[model samples]
Target: MNTYQTLLVSTLFSSALLFSATSHAIELPQLQQRWAEIKYQQTGKQQESAYQALLTEASAARAEHANDANYLIWEGIIRSTYAGAVGGLSALSEVKAARKLFEQAIELDANALDGSAYTSLGSLYYQVPGWPVGFGSDKKAREYLLKGLAVNPNGIDANYFYGDFLLQQKDYQAAIAAFEKALAAPDRPGREQADLGRRQEIMQALSLAQQKAK
Candidate 1:
């Protein structure tokens, strides 16, 4: 190849790489929106299908950005959501896969996405069964939740999930405090619907904890 032809080929290859990166950037926000929609889905079948699709997309994104903590976290979140939608023994397997993804994200950057991995992993530890069935552990759950809070004291998810763990531990007053903090958390741009749903969850849990205390 002559000098001019080699230069032209190199330019084209760089342009293609730029385009691919830009396309993935555009797709990431859409994936987040799809995840929000999946959260509010009313039926199990719909949730299962939506989450399955999201899983495929997120997995592809993770592959493209193998070292990106954010992509890995989203992949883990999608997988965990799919597991919840398909609850049963099989769900445990899915959660385990999600766990590994979250662990990898933490290994890369535990503070990525405002400590999202910690909150998700903490929730997994608490929600999954323990002993003969699964790898759940109250101790690990609290540890992760506290780490999440240390990084993001005012984060809505950090507060809410920590509060939830407290409620399970029967610490009603502490749970109420955490839920209140979650309710007072600042609204995130482009996340209005998710914030609303999370607020509802916080309120319900707060009410239940309050009732239990009485």
Candidate 2:
């Protein structure tokens, strides 16, 4: 081929590769697995270098698969993980970014995963301190949580957060019911063993709520 024709072909090939990389869909299960590992590392107070590397890789995957709402959701979740690892101003920034990304994902696909975005947003609102003050907002928290439950009654995060909110509100019976629902949720993401462990924890929480009710 002529020199100019070869150069043109090379450019086209490079462009194609770039497009393919950017348009690829991130694997949701793999992202969740990595996130769980990050969480474990944080809990153990171990070096998080590997977790950081995993986040970088996951971020790249999400960027490549920008069209996938789940990819966006995972990206937001990883950002929240990074926030927890690095406390202070950086953590706040990361969480804020995470919230925005999650909101975007919901806007893009509200009905995805039976309204996972609602669950995520509900948790964020419930957990995050209030603006111009602290993060405790039982009323607003309950509002979002209830909204999420309306979308998906069996949603894990929604049930868990709402249960906590109810406990805080001194509505022990409601708290117990919420936690029991969380434990019974069938589609939680994570390793099988880890999922079972979480269910057990939720059950324990339910028991506590039951005691409080009595």
Candidate 3:
């Protein structure tokens, strides 16, 4: 794989910090629950295969709940993660599909799943290649991530990703602040494993940002 694909694939499977939501409000709670398990519980080839299966399941869920922002966002999340898992030229198509799904979710409801669409899109914009290659754009990433924060300023995923973007931009202090906020975000009631994993990621980001600041 090329540089963009390599980085994109490795970083794609970062699960979202999901919170308990009203049953009717969430179109696919089962998918969300299964997703957290597959992302944080599974490992290596097993994890990758699970993600691949989950992507298919997510696609079916989307077909059933067409136009539902929740389903759209979840499916997009799965697509992105699966792309990261597979990591090849073929994965490129999956990410592209994921990007469109996120955009569609935003158009339907920017606040669905705690503004996850914006956050996912921001992550994708930064991960994908820019022009002449893919559609990655640091500028767009910052804009979308900030929009995600505007919708859910204290959201764990939003802050963590924003911090990641800042770190990439060499703003170590700002990245630290963002990671600190992410660490302070609330835990998911039914998603303890995902919370644990995300906390580990936040802590690692914190350590790196602190080191870079010194």
Highest lDDT against the true fold, candidate: 1
Ranking by lDDT: 1, 3, 2
Tens-place lDDT per residue, model 2, 11-107, is: 9999999998766644778777767756653453353565567677778787877877887787887776676676665567667777888788888
Worst 10 residues of 1 by lDDT: 21-30
List TM-score per model, in order: 0.87, 0.75, 0.84
Model 3 scores a C-alpha lDDT of: 0.87
Worst 10 residues of 3 by lDDT: 15-24
lDDT, candidate 1, 123-197, per-residue tens: 999999998899999999999999999989999999999999999999999999999999999999888878988
Off by over 4 Å in 1: 1-26
Q: What is the lDDT of candidate 1?
A: 0.90
State which candidate, 1 or 3, has the greater lDDT.
1
Better of 2 and 3 by TM-score: 3
Better of 1 and 2 by lDDT: 1
Best by TM-score: 1
CA lDDT scores, all candidates in order: 0.90, 0.72, 0.87
